[model samples]
Target: MVDDDDLILEVAQMSLEVVGGWEVTTANGARDGLVRARAEHPDAIVLDVMMPGMDGPTAAQALKADPETADIPIVLLTAKVQSADRDRFADLPVAGVLAKPFDPMRLPAELGSLLGWT
Candidate 1:
């Protein structure tokens, strides 16, 4: 998971770890996320849309651009709940888009559904 907000990162990490029983790696920003993504090669990425310097879409592009991370599925997490906002990613190679302020307990289920994980 990658997010600029410390609280979100912590909550998400804990939620995924405890509830989902998934090993999660996190980065605070898009640049760090790219680096981590390359090194760790996580099964999927939970990326935040709004951030300083590099946004989620740009980061997803960078991830897809490199062969090392190209195949990894990306699920965008955003505060923008509008369909138009979600439609912007139709051109990108993303698995799905999830709304922000998500239920911590259900996050794993939602993400798993998106990633087609049992």
Candidate 2:
């Protein structure tokens, strides 16, 4: 998971680990997220849309452009939920877009469904 907010990261980490029963690695921003995604090669990536220095869509482009990390599915987390706001990211190379202030416990299930996970 990648987000600028420490509280979001902490809560997401716990939710993913405990409730979702998934191994999670978090990055504080898009740059760190790229590095970690390259190194960790996790099953999926959860990215924040409004981060500083390389936002989620840009990061997703970078990930898609790189051969090493190109195959990893990206799910964007954004505070912008309006249709117009969501449409802004429609062209991005991401698996799905999830809203912020999410139900922490349901996050994994929702993400899994998006990715066709059992």
The candidate maximizing lDDT is: 1
C-alpha RMSD values across all candidates: 0.7, 0.8
Residue runs of model 2 more than 4 Å from their true location after superposition:
none
lDDT of each: 0.94, 0.92
lDDT of 2 by residue, 1-118 (tens): 9999999999999988998999999999999999999998999999999998889899999999999999999999999989998788888889898888999989889888878896
Which digits, one per residue and each the tens of the lDDT, describe model 1 over residues 1-118? 9999999999999999999999999899999999999999999999999989999999999999999999999999999978799679778789999898999999999999999996
Would you estimate the TM-scores of all the predictions?
0.97, 0.97
Show the lowest summed lDDT stretch of 10 residues, model 2. 85-94
TM-score of 2: 0.97
